[model samples]
Target: MKRALTDLAVFGGPAAFLRPLLVGMPTVGDRARFLARLEWALDNEWLTNGGPLATELEGRIADITGVRYCVATCNATAALQLVLRASGVTGQVIMPSLTFAATPHSASWIGLEPVFCDVDPVTGCLDPARVAELITPATGAIVGVHLWGRAAPVTELEKLAAEHGVKLFFDAAHAFGCTSGDRPIGGFGNAEVFSFHATKTVMSFEGGAVTTDDGELAEQLVALRSFGIDRNKSVTAVGMNAKMSECSAAMGLTSLDAFGETRERNRENHALYRSELSGVPGIEVLPFDESERNNHQYVILLTDHAVTGLHRDRLQTLLQAEKVFPQLYFSPPCHLMPAYRTDPPLRLEHTERLSERVLALPTGPSVSFEDIRRVSSIIRLAAERGEQIDAMWAGAVPA
Candidate 1:
């Protein structure tokens, strides 16, 4: 493996020598609980289509999110699609370019033009000012994302949406357990959709849900999820089969049961990163507000490559060489995707810059304190080399 990596390095884009650490992993407790739930399911013989487990998961998730109603779906993308359809939104929906492609794809799939807007570089969320500037008579809604579990400026964006009389949708895929003061993420906006993908802090193996305070919309969502079927078992609306299966619901139930432990572990990892990476030159570890009760993702921004001889991509390669593989959350940003590109194209300077430098380190329940120390040391060494190179270049430049 070492020889292969060395040879690859010689030719550029080396073969990875060590077993790559993944960003998300299910714990042993998670496995045991999941098996127990499956056993219960096997005994009951209820498999899918809003079964008892699915209903319980919806209720528990609703309670956890502090929302009046929650409707679970097959995945967050389906949840987003359901929300956009139920809201009766049309024309254009303004959304941040610095997000997963699903955000824009949902809007476009619903026949609404997705107008990509820039985000605040620091938060990687919709900038209220930029959103306001982009609002037009044709604009019917605004979809704001809480990137990396970091809360977007919801209050400001809500105010802006209200003033314009446009519907506000929040893509809270990364913010399942996130809270804003006393209110959780799902309690905000016209509706907030969450992801329970295997990678999230909470996993359903694969599932999602949409939360809303409106009773009518909640009913519509429930119907929408199950092929628009009403209590009479008649198709009421044009809906598809996006309902969360019993197995996924079982997984979600256990995940919620185990959420506290997972969240705390992730938070501890965040603290370790802070302690190790703080004041490290050429690398900027994003700040987390302890007051906000966050499950932090280890996202570092390579702000000045000149100072850190290794840029984000190069640093990722070096980390892989050490068997520490990090993931890039949203590399090209939504606007840069070939399907979503516009005529002149949206020149989102901040989004472009962030896509170039943002890197997500190995995180979640599986990362250990020792692993954090090793990753931090490698980053520090890379930054030191970067600083030296910067100084050398400064000296070499002619007056």
Candidate 2:
């Protein structure tokens, strides 16, 4: 609908929509069911410290993920930290820089040094070849992240980890209800951590879980989450208070009940985006494997400045002015963040390049089909008029 520069909201014209279309909006399940569960938790008066609801949630997660054991935590960070510690790994941990800061932060917080690795440019997941190149006697473990709800190079990473004799795990924050081949994500490696944060498709308001088939490791995690107190109620090992509350578990159950419906909606939105953006120069919608089960929670885009004549940041700004807000998921990647920056500075070519180009558009239950159409139209308009917009930006002074 926007015909020219003068018609764009960024150029002093009216916005395309009355309200902002935002990315990562929380998906609310059946309101009545959620309220009933909340009321039950309150009536029971068991809020935290491994209550009935928390225990039930853990069992459900284990069942859903096809893992023998599941330990729910206050958040994914805590789950990661606990899993890394309980896996009995020491020294350096290798992980991709193209991820949320929490991935490395968890390792670093537990006194392990995080070694940054580059990712596969197309998949946006850890490159096993890079991991092989980085492995040393000092490397304690290898962590792979499932980006955009797509499975990481699980088979290859498993092979590398086995050959090197190091522990392997996954940061499956974006991969709940997703699959790696015939298997579920949580069953991979020594363990996998999933986030149930509100933003996730299957949310618990604010919670996370660690899944594993290792009984001993599961016991250790159980003890670790509750300050290392064993059945006899005596301190055994150094631990942190990272238990999920009953309220969060109740919400989690409700969310799980609505998973199928939410996933369908997400799938529809993703399909609409792909169809609408097809053949639009310089804009690519990331694809998920059709054969495997996926949550389809994120609608990712890769902007090619060379073709579009506008970089990803400028395109994002243009969209935002029209009251459509997309997200730069991991622009300043983990290795580039202040807390995790390397001494001599690391140069991960693929990681750096992908970080700059990747953008997450609005999707999920909150976004309607019409919303996707409007957002897609805005992108198409920007791409079509990229040269003129680039020139206008070049001539304009910095604000």
Candidate 3:
């Protein structure tokens, strides 16, 4: 533990950790099983194009998500694009600005304008009231993001979409294996997309899937993921190459097999963080719902600079100096990015405020309980001496 500001690595003292603790370290499970599946794929010489392994993965995901059809893709962005294309929605899509850039990118890439909306201050998900306000005759769809494994306002978004005669879908990238009430996340909206990227709780060695109950839409998606070729070997529609390989599917299967254990470890880590940072003033470890099934993928913290006397960025720098690398997720948010920036400048009060305060700490299978404790100790110490640290930081900065 750091005794004084000078004892910190930033002050030329030894780092608390020799190696950097990272957020979103890949969770590799049962290596032997993954290898065996990989070997099978090799022996069969079936690498891609909806091979048997990919088919099995789709089935398993469908079963888990409680959706009728699961169309696996090369990545989540492609899955989103495919779903948007298949839905035939046009003009503009309303989405929270507090999401990964891919959410807006997917829509914009397919010729639809992405209108940024503010999120709910508490949940950090798309505000249904804001969505209602954004609806217009040209509003093609409403895309809700399940931020940090928490479900979006699904019921309300659904109602709004239905009332407005617009389509609805979710970017369930952070919400794989999560639930809202008893229903799984992937089963919500017209269709939902799950990201199995290396950073996610469940991974397919870089893959994603779109889950939906609409048979015709599913059929269209299946064809679209390929070269728009149908079962009859006829070109049905314009499409892109977005099929998940057998190797990725094998990894996906292994990830699913270990999901239970991973979820448990993540849950334990979250609990430990909450306990370790319990009474730290102006420091809040975001809470997950106990009633709903959650992947517990993120260990997020919200810092109140006024109360803590240290800004979130300064706290982040202090932690990083100790070799703990937390992420400022969705900072500069999608709306603020150069590609999406409006001429007049868009102001999303909630998103802007939350983006400055939110920080994602290290968790997942890679992080241990002891690591959480140490990280929390650094935070507690910093908060305890926040003013001093702030003064030190300010002095260190070159005028």
Candidate 4:
């Protein structure tokens, strides 16, 4: 066993082996396509602020997401802020702390108190029951995050919001190609924000959009994204410059052309991970059964320290030494961040536990099935010989 372990440490030359993916890379031919579209933009001389390409991208997104209205923005964070501001969300907004900091920051940007709520242990999305408990007289809305392309309880959350006369919104940064049953993710709640950041399932380099069925809300969002200018050039509302540029729109359209292929790759990668990692002791592969469509992000939960004899961080360190890089998405929840810390803090039990245990393994179209098998083997062997792996990692480091 010791001899076999040593072989893994030196099996492949560090520089020669393909480095594990830490971010999403644009699909091949995206550059040429983007450049081709840019040529048209240069010919037309419409650079930004609702140019033709941007308008076309907006329409395409609306059509794809099955929503009546879609407004492109500079980024997901800005898209979120625009939705909240345009919806007249004031006072307190109940949201999950188990998300990117931008979720809470968007609320703060609109001068709303982000009351942190707990999430479901299995799904890592805002627990609808916990959200109900957190809502109060001051609560103006609920911001549920579709964490890791998993659908939150959209129907239940919408019902709750409707019953309470509060709006329901989603920070659907991970849900571009995801769906709830047959209905797509963006066609839910008051408005759902989809991120096109480079790391997401589909990307426009750096862009986002808000999907809604309400025409009035959509109009307000369009105005808010620009400097409050309507079609009549009337400065009717307070706004900012959050328009998606012609270049970004061009990239988005190009990326959209390849999303069908990307979605299939994501599904294949997820299946590979589950097939390889399932039945490994102490490792819990969260149920991927809820969503009919998933933009795969490989999140493995190290749920049992006693069974595995190693915590999540220790396993991460060992994997790093093995040239397998896994990320702790939302390691420190929003409430724990320096900017959002409060007096005595909020008790988010699930958020803290999930943050510590969750490890987002390298995934996406670029990652291979062999890569999944390798990562799984590392975890399986580490669980079998925890102390030995730790010793090996320690010895490899220069004193």
Per-residue lDDT of model 2, residues 271-388, tens digit only: 9999999999899999889999999999999999999998899889888788888999789988888887778889999999999998999998889898898889889988987887
**Residue 67 local lDDT, model 2:** 96
Runs in model 4 lying further than 4 Å from the true structure? 1-17, 298-303, 390-399
What is the descending TM-score order? Answer: 3, 2, 4, 1
Write the candidate numbers in order of decreasing lDDT: 3, 2, 4, 1
Question: Which candidate model has the greater TM-score, 2 or 4?
Answer: 2
Best by TM-score: 3
**What TM-score against the true fold does each predicted structure earn?**
0.91, 0.95, 0.96, 0.91
TM-score of 4: 0.91
Instruction: Give candidate 3's TM-score.
Output: 0.96
Residue-by-residue lDDT tens digits, candidate 4, 356-382: 888877777777888778877777777
In the range 1-399, model 3's lDDT, one tens digit per residue, is 224444544434678536689999888799999999999999999999999999999999999999899999999999999999999999999999999999999999999999999999999999998888989999999999999999999999999988989999999999999999999889998999999999888899899999999999999999999989998889989989999999999999998898999999999999999999988899999999999999998999999999899999898888887889999977989888899888888999999999999999999888887789889988998888788788776564332
Query: What is the number of backbone collisions in each predicted candidate, taken in the order shown?
Result: 1, 0, 0, 0
In candidate 3, which residue pairs clash? none
Of models 3 and 4, which has the larger TM-score? 3
- In terms of lDDT, the best-performing candidate is 3
Instruction: Pick the winner on lDDT between candidates 1 and 3.
Output: 3
Q: Name the lDDT value of residue 349 in candidate 3.
A: 96
2 against 3, candidate with superior TM-score? 3
